[model samples]
Target: MARLYDYFLGGKDNFAADRAAAEKILEVAPELPAAARANRAFLGRAVRHLARNGITQFLDLGTGLPAPGNVHEVAQEVDPGARVVYVDHDPVVLVHARALLEGQGGTGVVHGDLREPEAILRDPGVLEAIDFGRPLGVLLGAVMHHIADSERPGEIVAALREAMAPGSFLVMSHGSSEARPAAVERCTEVYRSAGLPLTPRDRDEIGALFEGFELVDPGLVWLPQWRPDLSDMIDFAAAGPQASLGLCGVGVKR
Candidate 1:
């Protein structure tokens, strides 16, 4: 399988097959790179919010790639002692993360499927890096949709919700069909052809995942609208159909 990092940043780790698939997606939604950067911004802001709110433990699932502004680095900036457990099914990421975090006291990577929460939560690396009794940030950025409805996205989210302590939060950003149906539809078709299911939920369906949690301010807004970095972000936000095509939100466990 091709690693996400290969496709997300134009890296060479991708196979020719993956590159061909990515090209088809870009043909449909040309602003994908921008949307990715916007989603990364949401991850950073949400992590900062959690760290600022005294959450020092994080479980970043489906962490696509070991990019520069990684979740551990972002959280540790707020609290140097913060701990993070990064999970991904990609063997490349698994290998890379292990090497990158070598000798790093508070961080580690594990190979696991998000569908197996029990195993994931019980992994030695995860248990050692995080304390569930304390507030934890469960990050599902740009990944939940990959889990089909038959696999039960709602149930998976609810399980994560139950696992976290009160005051813990769920930070998420998902591709949607709201503002750019054509672009989203095109990309959806492309992914389906490549044997990947892309379910772009509507706002109401997206809200359903937070059924029992209290949504933070500016609830379930678009990518750039969710606590953007600056005024220029709004302008950049307005340019892409994908900006309005994705839903982002943070929900605190009550």
Candidate 2:
């Protein structure tokens, strides 16, 4: 799945299988690459926002294949001392992360699943890099939708939220069907046929994941609308409604 996402963003780290799946999705929705780019840009903005707001530690769950403007690269750019722990269940992502992301000071990669937040929280590498008592950022960019509703994604998010400090931030982006239901359903079916089902939620359902946290400015807006810079503004204006297919927001644990 991570490789498929990397392929969507025009990264060269993906294999032929990932490219095949991505091509199938593109057949359904050609705007997917634009949406993927918007989501990646949102991640850069969110991490920069958190780092500027005094978040020195980051717990990036479901960390995908290392691409340009990654969490550590964005956060560390803001503050050189920023600590980051990249978590992912996929061995391929972990291997690539360790080769490219680790060996740098205050950064480490852990093999873990987002569904099991407890184990992730308890991992030695996570504990070494992140201080739970201090304010940190938890990034869940374009990940939760892969988890089925039957798996209780809200509970998974709540568990992570409970572990965060009062001022910690939750930076998340999710795929939604509120604007274009039929198109999104076709996209979902494409993923399902590839053995990776997606559950694109409505705005309310996506907002529910942040139940215990207070939203920052522009609460739960589309990916391009959240604290966009000049470049993002141009992209958003050019992409139009396709940019809204993925919604993103940042919330503080109050």
Candidate 3:
């Protein structure tokens, strides 16, 4: 799934199988590439916003294949002393992250599953990079949707939220079915066929994932609606709501 996502983002880390799966999905929803770009842009904006606000540590859950404008890059650009712990269950993602994403002094990679927040929270590398007593950013970009309701995704989020300190930030983006149901269904079929179950939630359900935290400006809107850049502004308006099949927001634990 990570490799398939890498293909969607035009990265070269994907295999032919990943490409095949992504191509099938693209045939169903042609706007996916644009949506992936919008989601990536949101990640950068969210990380920059948190960094600028003095949050020096970040925990990037389900960190996919290494790419430009990654969390460490964006955060370290703002403050070289900023620390980041990239966690992903996929061995391929961890290998790529450790080789290409981890930097000296402050950045590290840990192989962990998002379903088990307790193990991730107690990871030695993660603990070394982040201080639970201080404010930090927890980035769950395009990850929670992969977890089904049977997995109790809400409880998983709540556990992570419980581990966070006051003033900590939670930045998330999830696949949403609100904009175009038919398109999302078709895309979901493609993923399911590939053995990757996708459970895109509606606006209210996605919004509920932020329980116990206060939303930031432009709360839980379309991905492009959250502090869009110039290109995002122009492209999203031209593509309409379909260009934003994903919902994104940031919240602070207060």
Candidate 4:
């Protein structure tokens, strides 16, 4: 399936069929492009925060297309020896990742599904990139909604929590259903039509994913509001379907 990141970023990696569906989504909710950008920004900020706090190793799950400022780039910028493992099931992402890691020593990308956290934890490449004995950052940026309700996102989170060491942090964001039902409906339809159906939950529902972890300060607010780079969230608020949902946060595994 064509990953939504490729579709959203207007990348040519997506199929013509995917592009048509993406266009329909744009027609339905114009702020989608802005929303995608905001989500990426949130990922950068969260990763930097964790890295600055001494969490050098990272496991970026459900990773989409390797954009310019990716997790490893952001983390390594903080600590030169930072190690990161980018996990995704998309074949195109895997191919690009291998090309990008030609000579990189501490950073690499692996192919895996978030639904199989155990497999990811045991993957030889992932084990090489991360150390379970030390604090790490487990990133699920803008990816949880991809898991169907049948999979129980909370359960999956718990599994991830169990796999990481104490003091590990989970940084995540999801397409929310609150305060923007129409936009959510439109995007949901777009993904569904493409055979990659997604389910956006409300604040309460999304909050459940952090059930076993200790939420960071200012827990669960709008993406722009979560330690905003500037005080200009008004533009984020105006992005209709891509409206600011403060859908990002960090949680410590205890």
Regions of model 1 farther than 4 Å from truth: 1-6, 231-244
The TM-score that candidate 3 achieves is: 0.97
Candidate achieving the largest TM-score: 3
Candidate 3 lDDT tens digits, 1-254? 88988988899998888898899999988888888888899999999999999999999999899888989889989999999999999999988888885346689999899999999999998898899999999999999999999999999999999999999999999999887899999999999999998999998999999999999998888988898877876656776845778999999999
Taken over the whole model, the C-alpha lDDT of each candidate is 0.82, 0.90, 0.91, 0.81
Indicate whether candidate 1 or candidate 2 has the larger lDDT.
Answer: 2
By summed lDDT, which 10 consecutive residues of candidate 1 come out lowest?
Answer: 1-10
Clashes of each: 0, 0, 0, 4
Worst 10 residues of 4 by lDDT: 237-246
Per-residue lDDT of candidate 2, residues 58-152 (tens digit): 99998899989988889989999999999999999999999996569989999998989999999999998899999999999999999999999
Residue 4 shift from truth in candidate 4, angstroms = 3.1
Candidate closer to the true structure by TM-score (higher is better), 2 or 4:
2
Model 3 off-target regions past 4 Å? Answer: none
Q: What is the TM-score of each candidate against the true structure?
A: 0.93, 0.97, 0.97, 0.93
TM-score of model 4 (CA atoms): 0.93
lDDT of 4 by residue, 135-200 (tens): 999998878888889987888898888888999999988878884787778778878877885888
Better of 1 and 4 by lDDT: 1
